[model samples]
Target chain A: MIVIELSERQLKIIEIVKENEPITSEQIAQFLKVTRATLRPDLAILTMSGMLDARPKVGYLYSGNNTVSIISEHVKRTKVSEIKSMPVVVDEQTTLYDALVSLFLEDVGSIYVLSHGYLAGVISRKDFLKNIMGGTDIHKMPVGLIMTRMPNIVTTYPHETALEAAIKIIEHEVDSLPVVEKFEEKGKEYFKVVGKVSKTNITRLFVELGRQK
Target chain B: MIVIELSERQLKIIEIVKENEPITSEQIAQFLKVTRATLRPDLAILTMSGMLDARPKVGYLYSGNNTVSIISEHVKRTKVSEIKSMPVVVDEQTTLYDALVSLFLEDVGSIYVLSHGYLAGVISRKDFLKNIMGGTDIHKMPVGLIMTRMPNIVTTYPHETALEAAIKIIEHEVDSLPVVEKFEEKGKEYFKVVGKVSKTNITRLFVELGRQK
Candidate 1:
């Protein structure tokens, strides 16, 4: 947690130490703008802060400390395979209870809604939760009303890097991105929901990578 | 845990239903090289096995089922941001115990060894475990001998996609790849270890995307 306040003299000292650590005070004072007496106090402070190393003959050296924050350091760059849950989907006309069971049993954050075998809408846990709480008939309602509609869907390539995807998650403020595979059927285009990614998946990755250490 | 044993008739039924799900069994039977009675049995078995859905009159459709494995599915994808740990690392001269402490405390899968401010080698948790079982002096042994050294140390660019890296991991049969950013120091070359990518990260990405459903 040492935040080094750079002074002109300290910066010079840093440069000198950077060149060759274990340098003597006399040589530093003679070559630099500051006096050895003036430099002594700075040296002592830097050394004490663990930012600098001190020696009897050689004056000092930067501790060579370069550290990222603990949380960021342990961050794992996931692959599509790691975060993608197998698809849990239903027709736009399926009963709410059926969708709820799929979401619950799969333990997924969201579910894809298909229409005649086409990517249609995404139904999230929040959507289902809100519906269940609103006293709606579980068997009567279809997911199409509450589901996020198409063209709004965020997706990733089966071959994309997780770090890039992480950036997308942060920037877009979206919790997950579906992994999709394109197929041609009956001479037409269709997007098959193959897998899914969630924020928890990102957290789990760090957990696993962190466990390695 | 139902493994759909495919017969030629069953495969034909699947292909037809897969292309046009919610299409009636009569239609599938018409399209396939089979009779309606034969298709009815396949449809019944598929639905019972959680592979298809049967509506009274609308016909039979693949349920998008059984693709999600309950066992592997729970190992959720997580962001790299949540874990609290320093980057797992050590100098070339550091004893195996020094690396082990970082490994155990952080619970990470791998540790990188640095020398002259450059990555020299990587030691995986598996490596450490195997070595310990082989009766090596963890306290006395320097990791230089056991580490996967330079050139053998596979790397990835920070900008590369997670999907690409995952394929690389499978291709290389390595546990992880150091995310590398290259630069010149004193007109010479060096690589800064920016981050790391592993299988867990890939899995986490999938989880994150799935949750957004």
Candidate 2:
């Protein structure tokens, strides 16, 4: 099980409560311009989470004790280099059949496309799956032809934390991110493939932290 | 940005430091069976996140003041009914092509497979993409033939919080979940599909909660 954080509506309720201390549920409803019944879930969540304490006729009061919440600080201070694992690399010229075999053999969700030891593109399960499902001649097609190329690829650095990595994963809707390091190669900026991070990495952190006191 | 939680390694380090107050970084590295250089990143993370305070000669101290951690409780208290959205449903008899059309038209990642208004299975983009890529006749094939069937399906109750839903999503490696409520149908147990929840919903909650004090 994971921890549930305050929802968007709950945050709004708290903000309103902070501005109007000891506010009644009805008053909060009015501020939000919604019915009292509609706010019941939000109120219940806030109260149960200890962000607000309520009493009959006393109204909702901001408990405000959750100062220094762990996650926010953890995200800010974590650099990408901390949790990244070595990337699964594949050459762009590799045939789709070879790439597919590599993907399953390595049991990795994605493989980074490398050209002469620099990041070039990425191919994932979906990419290969899509091609195979489409009846492409896997043995003849180069993986690079269908790979999501650079500049469009989302990447993170070792100096960034897993939190930033998670956001990129969610935002880009990709299963993994190539953790890269920047360098100037022949007067052109290039990101050298270094490591990778995925949604699993972030979720694992959540589970671990929740287990702590 | 998403809220960052401590990784298992970081948590273990904190536990060690807590048990051995004013412990040196060298002592931590020794206990973890790694060289001091290897532990530098973890130590930097802990210190920067305020979980630890280090002094030149004093070693490390557990600063442990994350009193308002949101996840553990929030996950336990919030129910699936609170965050679920209307499920995208399709009949088992629907052709793969039709189902694929519905999935894209609805702009949803997954579709619930319903047999006579009771959920029988689930089909997702991966499923469709896989089938189409495999050279299957989408027009002739029924979605039910290839869908992940019941009992094997991971589901959640409306009364369960989003935290459980999130964990199920991660553990099962599914993009979304069908929120369900159990009912007795002719002396047999059946789960009535009520709504749906996705990873996006969970991450959105985290972002909103983190933005609050």
Candidate 3:
């Protein structure tokens, strides 16, 4: 039987919850750029399916299968224990020509810009292309000047479901996400760097997993 | 900057013929499928790199820009064209227990077994699961004797990419290939039940196509 029974629209709602639960329906309507009337039925289906646990104060939260929930929680607790690579972040300060070559050679869509080993900004191929295509002096311009900064981005722990990873790709319409090593109190890792989950990799990984069945 | 392009066995060649030319070494040992050294190199690297042309007595192939030839002749021409859906067909003889409870209610995997209008065989969660779990009951049973019958299975048109449809679940793996309606010899609308691709969808189709900066 299909376990997670949610339509595309309903799933969108669940995803919004992922971004931040205990969020109100009004905020959901505003966040998705959809109307409450349209959101109502979608919410109804999710609620009916018992995929969301509702409450008087807390808005909507995902109520996945016990197995999935337990797995997600355990993984969340671990986050990234240690970063393998010393984050060589690419920011607006990074040159366009350098960024292009780095991304291609590394086979990564993005490079994080770290200031003192902290995520300062992020630059992607799409961003680099747009600017370079505009006849800008890519070789001279630092990437930091053209990178996407914090808050506008989304990140997940190493323990999160690759399912969650897949959803992030679809929901945000991005090619890859930076896998970070979140620290507890005094920032042991400073989120140096770990790995990335690209949309293409996500699709291929799931297909391989399915085949084991 | 990438230095080692060839794999381990590829490094032990006796002679350095071509840098990256497509040679028909298969003539020497193509069918053997033992080692890369079996096939000979095309006249080493002739006036290639956009210059050479194929000719007899010239090793195997011209070391020219075969990339363009590959794109224009092979890659572009071999495409999945004109997709149409097959009617959900299953046998009426199938136990309602499978259809209503398994395929419909429980949303078991979809299956189809057709033979000249008289649909036979079946595809479903139980069919595949039982097969995987070592349930012998399915092997002895006939889908026609237990299928959901016509207007039950799902098929597609000719223009659609089978890979596209296969990736819809983004999770579920399919065993029985879907039947697509495409042209036959006489540009006929009737489907000839063309060749099948697999759950791997592994044409190794992963790279995103777009202009690079």
- Interface CA RMSD of each prediction in angstroms: 28.1, 12.3, 27.8
Give candidate 1's whole-model lDDT.
Answer: 0.63
Question: Per-residue lDDT for A58 in model 3?
Answer: 73
Instruction: Estimate the TM-score for candidate 3.
Output: 0.34
Cα error, residue A130 of model 2, in Å, equals 5.3
lDDT of 1 at A149: 87
Q: Which digits, one per residue and each the tens of the lDDT, describe model 2 over residues B51-100?
A: 68998889999887654343445444556787777888989899987887
DockQ of each: 0.01, 0.09, 0.01
lDDT of 1 by residue, A1-213 (tens): 111233566666777877877778777777786666656655654454455777766567678742211222113334667666677888999877788767657756578899887788888654554454355666788888778887788877667766556656655656577777777879976787777765555545534443431
Off-target runs (Cα >4 Å) in candidate 2 are A1-72, A106-109, A125-136, B1-76, B105-109, B125-135
Q: Which ten residues in a row have the lowest lDDT in candidate 1 chain B?
A: B70-79
The lDDT values for all models are 0.63, 0.74, 0.46
The weakest ten consecutive residues by lDDT in model 3 chain A span A66-75
In order of appearance, the predictions have TM-scores of 0.36, 0.63, 0.34
The interface root mean square deviation of candidate 2 comes to 12.3
Error of 3 at A113 (Å): 2.2
Q: Could you tell me the lDDT of residue A103 within candidate 3?
A: 65
